[model samples]
Target: MSTVSVREFSYNPSAVLARVEKGEAIQVTRHGNVIAILSPAGSPMERYAHLVAQGKIKLKPVTAAERHSMPHYEVPEDVDPVALLLAEREEDDR
Candidate 1:
C-alpha cells in the first residue's frame, strides 16, 4: 500500500482515484497520522484474485523493499499565477 498526505490527495483527486481503480491501495494521512484507506471497487483481495487463480502468486507476498519518498512541491500562498503567466507571455514576445 502507498501513503499520501491529505494535501497531496486533495490536490489531484482524479489521479489518486485512477490509481485506486487500477488496484493500487492508498493510505490518506493528515499531519503524519493516517485518516483513511482507499481500496479498489471490489474486495481488498480482489486485486490479487486473478493472479491467484492463474497460480502465479500462491497467495503469498513477495514484494521487494522500497524506501523512496516522493517529492512534494509547495507554492507560496501569495503567489499570483495570472501575473506569472503574463510575465511568461511577455518574455515569449521578445
Candidate 2:
C-alpha cells in the first residue's frame, strides 16, 4: 500500500488516481491517521491487462529450464520471522 497526505491528495489527485488505476492500493491520511483507501475499480486481471496496454507492465514467458534453475529456501520451524523483524526494526530506531 502507498500513503499520501490529504493535502497532497488534494493538490495532485491525478497522480494518485493513476497509481490506483494501475492496481495499486493507496491510503489517504489526514493528520497522520488513515482516512480512506483508493483501489482499482475492476478485477485484478482486467486492471493488469489495462496496465499492459498502457505499457506500464510487461509480460514475459519463462522457459521450463529457467524455472527449474530458480533457487528456493527452506524455513526453519524454530524461527519466528515476525519477532525477528520487529527486533530488527527496534534496533534500527537506535
Candidate 3:
C-alpha cells in the first residue's frame, strides 16, 4: 500500500500511475487526510492483467524454512567469491 498527497499527484501524474502499475494500492489525500483509494477494478484476472501490462507484477517461488533445529554448518574457506555471489543470486531467483 502507498499514499500520495493530492498536490503531489497534480504536479506529477505519472508517479501515481507508476505506483499503481507496480501493483501497489494508493490512497490519495487532501488537506492531510485520505480522500480516495486508487486501485484496480473488475475481477481478479482482469486486475492481474492490468498490473502485468503495466510491468507491476512479479512472480517468485516461496520455500518454507525448516521448522526444527538443525546443526550449524560453515562454508568452505577456499570457496571463490564470484561463485558465492552467483549462488546467492540463484537462490534469490528461486
The best candidate in terms of lDDT: 2
Per-residue lDDT of candidate 2, residues 1-94 (tens digit):
5779999999999999998988887767788766666767764344455454344665455699997997554537798856877877899999
lDDT of each: 0.70, 0.71, 0.63
Model 3: residue 13 alpha-carbon error in angstroms: 0.9
Across 5-87, the per-residue lDDT of candidate 1 in tens digits comes to 99999899999999998988776778876666677877546666555434465433334443134323344769875576687
Q: TM-score each candidate.
A: 0.47, 0.44, 0.42
Q: Which stretches of candidate 2 lie over 4 Å from their true place?
A: 43-94
RMSD of each: 18.0, 13.5, 14.3
TM-score, model 1 to reference:
0.47
> How many steric clashes does model 1 contain?
0
Worst-scoring 10-residue span by lDDT in model 2: 44-53
lDDT of 3 at 26: 69
Worst 10 residues of 1 by lDDT: 64-73
User: Model 2, residue 34: displacement in angstroms?
Assistant: 0.6
TM-score of 3: 0.42
